[model samples]
Target chain A: GEEVAQTPKHLVRGEGQKAKLYCAPIKGHSYVFWYQQVLKNEFKFLISFQNENVFDETGMPKERFSAKCLPNSPCSLEIQATKLEDSAVYFCASSQSTSGGHNEQFFGPGTRLTVL
Target chain B: AQSVSQHNHHVILSEAASLELGCNYSYGGTVNLFWYVQYPGQHLQLLLKYFSGDPLVKGIKGFEAEFIKSKFSFNLRKPSVQWSDTAEYFCAVRAISSGSARQLTFGSGTQLTVLP
Candidate 1:
């Protein structure tokens, strides 16, 4: 695909339920990133992957949030024990690996998750 | 930690009005700057970026931004804005040093409403 793709444009989960989001990077892109947009304005980086390997997980909440990118599958971000504060729009982005990491990241039509 | 600031929370302008949006980042090292626009009910699209070389970069839809290292600012400008140009604008920055993840740090977006 020429553009990054995200699944389940909208997801609704009750409190304590698990919610999962999927993202497929551009066909030739090697890096995938996930960001959470809260309050419709603030974007917080959650994690990133280099191919199928995790490149960075600094922003991820270790206890309840987990992500994976496996070969031949779309990347997944899972949130266990969903809370009202966890409601947000999850955006997926992909970029080609560059020497200096200055490449432009192509974003997907974010998945809006609503936790009640 | 790198942080970005978008001073204008909301801006209203008449059609064909010249526009300027201010963005500043707090980082001392080499950085890559970018501006992204999100039209209503649409996904985010890259407006322009500043990696290296010239500080002035032009993006789609007659938008341009200038990176000022001295002021730690990347201000977006348009000679004339149309009603269709109404959107939310975000400024993002990524540190260009080794060992830094390729995740972008974005600012709180600015809502630009152009009245025709």
Candidate 2:
């Protein structure tokens, strides 16, 4: 029952512009994750949040990329001053962690960001 | 550091043919593995996962993957793949730890093209 929902299925932005992607995690789920797939290469972890608190963000770009999970509102990953290289499919995932079960992360329809 | 390796970048196969996409990891400890699929214009969905117990796991849509511990591999297989199975598949692994840094690491995906 843990499903992630991402808005803005497609986005076109210019160089130096800003792009914001949104994700609504499954209700009652405590963990949210973001990933970027560039040039159809691989899905790289961008950040992870646990109940509005960042658990790990080492894979995230420090300068231009910032993500936040607001209370009630869905989580958002914002990219300021987007470059050509920043164009990719951004995916959001969520997982519900119990005592002893397979903690499988479910993915959402990605936001395809195209920088022209 | 955890890293995943997928043997094929792109595979073209005929309809109703068997499929075996090779996936391997580079970790020495207890790890969790999963296979995810993304259709041409759809969201990424979980195919199967391996955390504990049986090495062979069955997933949705007649897909199955085997988690071989000694080999550090979790290869996905299907007895008969259809044209609808043409999609990009990702292999992911994460250390089953309670640490804050435990995040799923994905490999460069293998794109399966089932020809009709």
> Model 1 scores what on Cα lDDT?
0.94
Clashing pairs in 1: none
- TM-score list, all predictions: 0.98, 0.95
Model 1 DockQ reads 0.68
Chain B TM-score for all candidates, comma-separated: 0.96, 0.95
Which candidate ranks first by DockQ, i.e. highest? 1
What would the per-residue lDDT of candidate 2 be over residues B61-88, giving only the tens digit for each residue? 9999999888999999999999999999
Best by TM-score: 1
Model 2 stretches with alpha carbons more than 4 Å out? B99-101
Worst 10 residues of 1 chain B by lDDT: B94-103
Q: What is candidate 1's lDDT per residue for B11-70, written digit by digit as tens?
A: 999999999999999999999999999999889999999988889999999999999999
Superposition error at A78 for model 2 (Å): 1.0
Per-model i-RMS: 1.9, 2.6
